[model samples]
Target: MKVCLVGSSGGHLTHLYMLKPFWQDKDRFWVTFDKEDARSILKNEDVYNCYFPTNRNIKNLIKNTALAFKVLKHEKPDVIISSGAAVAVPFFYIGKIFGAKTIYIEVFDRIDKPTLTGKLVYPITDKFIVQWEEMKKVYPKAINLGSIF
Candidate 1:
């Protein structure tokens, strides 16, 4: 299966890395902002750089739209899994439009409250996995996977 692991750097990247082993034999690609840490970790793998906005900037939105088109055309992943902050938004919707199976993993830091991307993508996501059992209260359909870390 071709899988696109989309997320921001830092903890989101860390969480995605933990799931890498599961797809070792499958074709998987990573997408994140072009940050040093993100580039360093994903150096050995297939990586796509997408601009992420600082706020809700229009320029970034345009950049992301172009980037989304590039990703959809080049990667053509069969599935998309995201543990994200903001960048996941465009990728998630693009993946859905392309008829890819989308999976959303609520971040580990969001045990008490839901992340915006988690809530936004819930309805369209094929699978919703949460690290905390408490999250099930907020998203009843989510599967508790403990923590991939």
Candidate 2:
């Protein structure tokens, strides 16, 4: 199976990395934003960088959309998994439209409060995973997968 492991920089990527073993036997690719930390993590993997806008305002949504299309066209992954802050929105949306199974893994920090991405992607996600069991309170259907790191 072809997989596109997509996420923003920092903790989001770290969480996804913990699930690396699952992709060890599959055809996988990494799609992440360009950040100094992201550069370090992607060093030994097949990776594609996407323009991750610093601003989350409405003005930059169009550019984010374009970047999403670019990555979707090039990768053509059968499944797209993301630990998101902002960039995952476009990736998940475009991946779904392209007939890819979209999986959303909520960030680890959301033990007490619901994150923006979690709320937005939960209902639409083909698979919704949470690191904390308490998250099930916020998203009743979320699967508790424990800590990734």
Candidate 3:
């Protein structure tokens, strides 16, 4: 299956990377920030850099939404996954329109509350995964997969 892995550069990227066992054999590409860590981690993989400082940043959000439309149309992945900061919002929303399955893994750090990106994408996600059981309370339909760390 073709997979589109999307996230921010640092911890979000790392969280997605930890699922290498699941994605390693699949036809996959990444959508992330064009930062040192992202470059280093995904050097051998296909990478698309999206606009950043996305938290509460309207400009980057618009830019990324456009980028998402372009990439999702081109890739036409079977699935889109992310442990996000903000960039995942556009991809997940647009990917749905492309008929791609969407998975959102809530970051491991936030046990008591949902991240902004998580909240935004929750309604549309095909599978909503939570790293902590407590997060299920915050996201009632979320599957508790425990920590990806």
Candidate 4:
């Protein structure tokens, strides 16, 4: 199956990368920030680098949303997965409209609180996987798949 693996750089992308064992064999492409780590790790993969500073900035969100739409249209992935910072917001929501099965993996660091990306993507996501049981309290419907670390 074709997969669109997406997330921001740093830990979010790190968590997404943990799933490489599962998705590496699948037909896949990535959508993420153009940061050093992402470029270094995904160097040999099909990567679509997107804009950053997506922390509720209307202008950047709009721009990224358009980029998300364009990439989803072109790739037509069967599944779109992300462990986010902020960029996953536009990608998941827009990809949902395009009929891609959207999966959002809550980060491992968050225990006391939920990330804004998790809260925003939950409603539209097909599967919301939490790394901690405490998160199940925050996201009741979320699947507690334990730590991705």
Top candidate (TM-score): 3
lDDT of 1 by residue, 122-142 (tens): 898899999999999999999
**What TM-score would every model get versus the actual structure?**
0.92, 0.90, 0.98, 0.97
Name the weakest run of 10 consecutive residues (lDDT summed) in model 1.
Answer: 52-61
Please list the residue runs of candidate 3 whose C-alpha ends up more than 4 Å from where it truly belongs after superposition. Answer: none
lDDT scores for all predictions? 0.84, 0.82, 0.94, 0.90
Decreasing TM-score order of the candidates: 3, 4, 1, 2
Per lDDT, what order, best first? 3, 4, 1, 2
The segments of candidate 4 whose C-alpha lies over 4 angstroms from its true place after superposition are none
Candidates 3 and 4, the one with greater TM-score: 3
- Candidate 1 at 103: error in angstroms? 0.8
Instruction: Give the count of colliding residue pairs in each prediction.
Output: 0, 0, 0, 0
**How does candidate 3 score on lDDT?**
0.94
Per-residue alpha-carbon lDDT of candidate 4 for residues 24-113, written as tens digits (9 for 90 to 100): 899999888898999999999999988877887889899999999999999999999998878899888889899999989989989858
Top lDDT: which candidate number?
Answer: 3
Question: What is candidate 3's lDDT per residue for 1-149, written digit by digit as tens?
Answer: 99999999989999999999999999999999999999999999999999889999999999999999999999999999999979999999999999999999999899889898999999999999998888988999999988887
